[model samples]
Target: MAGEPQPSGAPTKGGWITFPFLIATMAGLAVASGGWVSNIIVYLINEFNIKSVDAAQIANIINGCVSMFPILGAILADSFFGSFTIISASSLISLAGIVLLTLTAVIDSLKPAPCENGSTLCMGPSKTQLGILYTSLALSSIGVAGTRFTLATMGADQFDNPKHQGVFFNWHFFTMYAGTVVSMVGFVYMEDNVGWGLGYGLCVAANLIGLAIFVAGKRYYRLMKPQSSPFTRLAYVIVAALRKRKVLLSSKSEDYWQETQAEGTKFVRTTPTNSFKFLDHAALIIHGDTNSDGSIKKQWNLCTLQQVEDLKTLFRISPLWSTGILLSTPIAIQISLTVLQVLAMDRHLGPTFQIPAGTMMVFVMLSSSISLAIIDRFLLPTFQKLTGTSATPLQLIGVGHALNVLSMAISALVESKRLETARSYNLNGNSIVPLSVFWMVPQLVTVGVGEAFHLPGNVSLYYQEFPKSLKSTAAAMVSMYIGIAFYLGTAIIDFLQKTTRWLPNGINDGRMNNVYWVLTLIALINFGYYLICTWLYEYQNVERKELSKSSPYPC
Candidate 1:
């Protein structure tokens, strides 16, 4: 596998192959870790008594916290621990969580009682089940946060610098989907059919394998130093932007001179313009009458504070991006809530029909994988060529979400019909839907395209907007979006079941029918968010050469 034994002494371009493999290994681990939780939603709902929405909330809290933690993980990875130590530590904690889950599952008395929904019988377990689950989830979150950033950075490491990495950047995402392709099958099977103890035990084993793979390749992998303090600097930018006095611009003809005193030296703002004190750097061209000679004097100062604003300003204001990702709540629900909902409904998927609740995920990810191959191999490039703008990722996302809007619209419609039938009968593995089970396949495929588009969008967008100093921070944006989307989805579903149409006889009321529509509404909101983000996108790219400029660390 190391290819022709490396010829003992000869130098090789192994970096190309080795670096990518290492990254894939890490990405694969991330997928498996996450898949464990994703596949468990059904178990939590059916065997454990956790309700559809609450189960989703539980998954969201765990997954979201892990993602949110990366902000800190980035801090730690950059400053104190470095990628190796932090990633290792995170994996161990997650391992501990898996161990605990297994032990508690075996003990039985330690498990949580299912939520108090009248739809199913309530079973008693240990009062500590909930606590143990929370602890396990939190541990997994920490590991996930740690793993996510390093892998992306490591993937980017395969390229000499960020410049030539553009195509690789696209491949990076494709490989990530590749890992999902595997986990979608492997983890889903373990979580659903195997039950909790062995299911989590396998997760632990997979993480161990993943960790070993990382350790073995430590010599080949690259680790970058943390660029800057996100929180501290963000705070500084906000205070500076708001607290500083505003500067007024003055202009004139003969010898046109404008000045402001700052930090002492009669600082010239630009080579050709009046001084503006507020901007760290400013560029301007001024018209001035030269004695008997006509000349236009231009001044430019690479004003850091004024022109670029401070990176901290990003912290001060983040509404649009946050809300936009929040719209993706259904994504989180799909893995957690929807998986459970699908499992509980007495699927009629027989030899010609039955779709394993967890196993179906492989098809879901397969759709994404095929979509990725098509997009990276064809669709995105083709779209980019036709659009004449470098907005490949956004274009796909916008279109995908539009299709998604329609797909969910169908889900909402189908679910409504299904629910009416659900009222009189409890659906099971052998149960039938009013429409053929095949109808759900399109919904699955729609979710798949959204997966492909959204994942790449998060990766590219963050990498671009984040200045060189904060590329690692930029990497975490995907996790953050996933987190927000998951939580918001849960909130919306909960709101619907508890507050509106589903309230009296709503899906949340221990019934399968109500859960479907709640998910439908969430998809609609997410679609709206997707539309706005696509429209407002000021698509940008990071030149590979800038990678050398941004990082003092070696790739």
Candidate 2:
């Protein structure tokens, strides 16, 4: 009864019945997050009077924190609170942050005096003002960290079939991008045209609505119970292996300790594999390692073979995971830099409509949304029909890597052309160039397509391959690397500003094209490293012979 599959459309706690509520909530939160985050660069410049490069650096730090904090959220969910509790609490926290942010927009005392148009002199925000802004950003970022990937994991948990889970991931990203598109296009326009206060107010409303929708669907959720920290088990495995470092290896399965079931019940025993053989010592049946009844005497000294293998699995996949950090770093740099680029370029569309500088990112989101639809609806099915197998996650990631490299190259070329135009017009020192902002569309769309390929591929691979005990944490791994990438991007920008002349206070006064070239080189090198890692990597879950028969696309 425990493992039996629920009939389709049966009265169940989790299934397609929960889809609409989850998707709606995801879209709402995305709109809320995008409203403030997408426009923060302009807000700092116009409201707080911060310099452009400084604001971008600050934004990068905030992005890094938002991306990195998800691991802590995942840990809390996996070890103590569970997804439902964490998401609910986080939504409230996010609402509080947005309220504070809106207050900053409405209250003149909360920000600095605006600089006169074309005036070089500007008043910086006082310490108190900056403190309030930082606090609000911190709270909002923490809230986002908790809900973003955890929602993906929870949505996937609603279905037992891998194909269903894959489809859910596709829709999850689509809804997220769709919501971001709305915030970037709609809310950003309001912030630029109507008022920042009204724009932030909309974010607060969206957060409240999303939270309400999530709560309303509580009855249909199949919540996973919190397990004690999976990381603790991993630590125990490492400790046991190191303690038995000098012990001889055993070739026989009986020499390893396996976790047993209820008394007198039969269970399959897991034996340590030859890969990462040193860790097998943790599971070796030394004297005093087990009680007379065959239970573990000390967890710190004797780990189950299954635990050993879980640690080994992490070791095997970590190289691939490291590749994602480098891959993401360039994109993070591009995102912050692209906003600056848009600000300096002509944004007028037709007669009365001038594109919001912040809304340039909408192109990336829109491209990703469209590409996801095509990939899910046409590309995957077509690939399966032709080859009798769906495209592997590694292959998808590889394609993303190549596209990312090309995008960086294109960004460099575009930046070079923008600079040439600026010099031709004698525009300098933060002056806007006559170049159309649409010149950036190609690079933005390329990166968006790359994200559509890699983001889901990375998540699907991590979720499918990780041990069951670490499911939530597995989903958060992608966030962790992305966080690291953002930090790395910030660090690189800071170093370039301090050491090189490429990035200055005014991007037009510096060689911004060179920055794109550097990122392009970094991406190219990272792709080569990724190819090596993928070459050495073997599938632990998706490519299993039995599973291959059930689903062409296990991931």
Candidate 3:
């Protein structure tokens, strides 16, 4: 009765009923996050009098922390607190951080004196100011870590059908991007035209509204209880395997420790496969390894066959996972560099209106949102109808990889042209290039389209393949790699600054085009690496044939 489907049309705790609240909450948080994060580079340069390169470096580090802290959040959600608790607590933390940030904007003592136009002598923020700024950033980053992907897992958990889950993920990303686009355009405009105090005050208001909506949905949610730590079980398998290194291999299913369900239910026994055979030792039954009733006797010295296989699954998927790091690193580098590029180029749309440098990324978010909708509504259906089978996650990811390489190539060419235009005008030493900033839009749109293909693909692949017990952690893996990529991007910039003239403090004086070219090469190499990883990888949870039949737009 517990696992059986509810009767048709029966009332359910979660379904489309929770959609409005969840989507609203997601949009609200996205606006709040994008408002501050998108403008931070400009804020530091204009308000704090930090150098352009130094501001980019600081932004990269903050992005890294925001992305990386999701693992800790996921761990806590999976092992102790359920997603609801984490989301609630994190929302409050975000509100507090946003309030503090608003205070800094309003209070003169909290930031450096405004730098005069064309003046090189500018005072930086004091230690006390920097400390407060860092504290607010830290709190906000922690808040983002907890709620971003955790919300995805929680929303997906509401449905029993994988097809519905996949659709939800698509819309989830769409809502996120749509919110970002709004912030990039509206809030950034506010910050540029009105004042930082009003812009940040709006972010604080959005956070409060989002938190209230999320709390209002408590009754509609089908909340999953926290389980024992999946990481601990993974560790047990490793420890047990090493301890029983001398044990002989077994081919018989009965030799392995298998778990049995309820008495009335039929239990299917599974044997360890030949892949990663050394790990099979952990599942091999030994004296005193289990109690008389088949209960685990020593947690570290013995593990279920399922536990061993879960660890193997992680090992097998690791190469594919590693490829994501390289996949995202180039994008990270382009993001920070593009901000710098927009600053030096003319951003005017007409004689009366000029585009804010911070709002330039709106192109990426807009493209990604539109692309996601098109993919879900048209492309996927067309592909399925033509082939009588759905496109696989790996196929989508491969396409994304190819597109990313092209984006980098285009970025390099565009940056080169910008430099040429500057030289033609006899520009030097932080002078604005005569070229229009729209030149960067093509590459930004390209990367955005690539993200639409790969980001949800990666999340879908991990969620479907990972052990059910580690679902929250699986969703957070994307954040982890993105975090690593941001840090890697920072390191790459630092290395170039120290060793070469590729990334000078004043980007106009440096060969920024060469930097983009290097990223293009790196992306090409990484794409090749991704191919190899996908070639050898097999789907562990969903069979290829079954997956094709289930959903036209599977993840």
RMSD of each: 9.2, 3.5, 3.2
Candidate with more favorable, higher lDDT: 1 or 2: 2
> Better model by TM-score, 1 or 3?
3
lDDT of 3 by residue, 38-125 (tens): 9999888888888888899889988998899878777787779988899999989988888888888999999999988888788999
Question: Which candidate comes out best when scored by TM-score?
Answer: 3
Name the best candidate (by lDDT): 2
Which runs of model 1 end up more than 4 angstroms from their true locations? Answer: 1-21, 24-28, 112-121, 163-176, 220-223, 241-320, 346-355, 380-393, 423-437, 501-555
Better of 1 and 2 by TM-score: 2
lDDT of each: 0.56, 0.88, 0.87
Summing lDDT over every window of 10 consecutive residues in candidate 2, give the lowest-scoring window. 546-555
Write the residue-wise lDDT of candidate 2 on 118-161 in tens digits.
88888999999999998999899889878887787778778888
Q: Whole-model lDDT for model 3 versus the true structure?
A: 0.87
Model 3 TM: 0.92
